[model samples]
Target: MRRPATTRAITRATTLAAAALVAAGSLSACAVGGSDDGPLVVVSTNILGDVVENLVGDEVEVMTLMKPDADPHSFEISAQEAARLRSADLVVSNGLGLEEGLQQHLDAAADEDVPTFVAGDVIEVLEYAEGDAAGTPDSHFWTDPARVLDVVDALAPVLADLDGVDAGVVEEQAADYRAEVEQVDAEMTESFASIPAERRALVTNHHVFGYLADRFDFEVVGAVIPGGTTLAAPSASDLADLVGAVEETGVPTIFAESSSPDRLVQALASEADVHVDVVELFTESLTAPDGGAPDYLTMMRVNTERITDGLSA
Candidate 1:
């Protein structure tokens, strides 16, 4: 059985924080690119890295730059990893301004003429409905399985065209993965539909669930932070407004991203007039294999169940 989100979240956050410190010292010594035999696909975030790995399997070497449980909005790459980007056969990123810290490296690779596949480019982008980032494109499209299918459809062709990858194998894997995404979408639709309309309000740590809310018919009541990126801080008045929304909506649960600490969400819950529970969801990055949200599919499933339970209660 999987551990409780609170238990797992605290453990993973503490472990990852220590790991980051250790990694800072050892990253330079660690290898960035894989062995020199096959075409290498360097991915910006671990979530998309898992997707590329699933699609290409052993056909090509896949290098994911972001560490597990790291914030994509602020995670930075080492000099070695940045150098490897220019030499990669294909560079994949969850663009739409998500990778704030790594954008320069991505741009550098693009300027060098490295082929790039941005997941945001192929999907119908959604803008933040109401926040400091209200008019900007949201990079959290992976929250919805349907949009993820769009990414897979566009990415499969790119991977197949790579020199060392087998077109037939990549095509077959893409089809199978597409089916999995479709199944998950159907399941999510059914699960979310069961939620009472009035109870389907969501409060989160940041504006990361617009895509999921748009896809599932949930109302985004408010967020602790006012924008799309976690790097931005929420003002006292901003928190006051969110507390009012929580009271007005009577939203019982507020979600915190697994990649970030839940202290802010906890504080928000405490300040709300209505009693609220804080739940953790895997929004930004994939976790290590032993972590609860190890891959994209599992991450979606885990979040679906958690959201359903949180709102229903």
Candidate 2:
């Protein structure tokens, strides 16, 4: 006997639905793709996640919403990770408008009464120039090791309050980390001082190194993209202007952020019609444990050496 049309249609619909359910389940199974166990600390970016991991030191679970080397400005969390943020014992974020896509989720987590800590809240913030960023605040605080020391200082006390955490351990780890940060700072300061005054100029893919510039006394000639975030693209005239700045400022290298595309910075260097080198630096994100910049201290040290070499060349 032949099946009725209605029965056949229903069978097809059911099969489609089951397939959809399986696919959805698979996606949800690895939602946000991070570790989860013990008291949870959900951080917005991998950089901060590394810091939190070091500070907490297995006392509690640490889950970073952003993937390794992901751009903090535009990286977003999954719905499941957003839910985790809401339920996490503490949600730590860079704040200062850095996580543009994740800001709403951070706010949602805070609204749900989850304990939240904004690293920008404790550290001093820098602003863009009058015509550079339309008056946006600079959000790349981790560029400055001194400021990262400030982050460690702020998080140590807050993390100590989490249940099952030992305050003594937190303080000790924080103190050790601060010393490391200071050591890197001193090393970078001395390394950067070796560059001649005329060679201390910088031109990057974007306005990423403001904190580094301010801390180390390097002049930010300009960026290929005239803003703090990489989401903004450059107009022909913007590239033209940066090319002129590169030539006029005598920038030896146009530093491209490791996390951002180098096409535009390359274009600027190519347009400069000079022998300007385009050097890659781990500016915003941390690499995997096996990568050169696996942690904050290593990242800073690597970038310091790269910048020092690139500029002094």
lDDT of the structure predicted as candidate 1: 0.91
TM-score of every candidate relative to the true structure = 0.88, 0.86
lDDT of each: 0.91, 0.86
TM-score of candidate 2 relative to the true fold: 0.86
Q: What is the lDDT of residue 4 in candidate 2?
A: 100
Clashes per candidate (backbone, < 3 Å): 0, 0
lDDT by residue for model 1 over 184-276, one digit each (tens)? Answer: 999899888888889999888899989998988888888888899999889999999998999998988999999888899999999988889
Give the per-residue Cα lDDT of candidate 1 at 269: 92
Model 1 scores worst on lDDT over the 10 consecutive residues at 28-37
Q: Native-vs-model 2 lDDT? A: 0.86
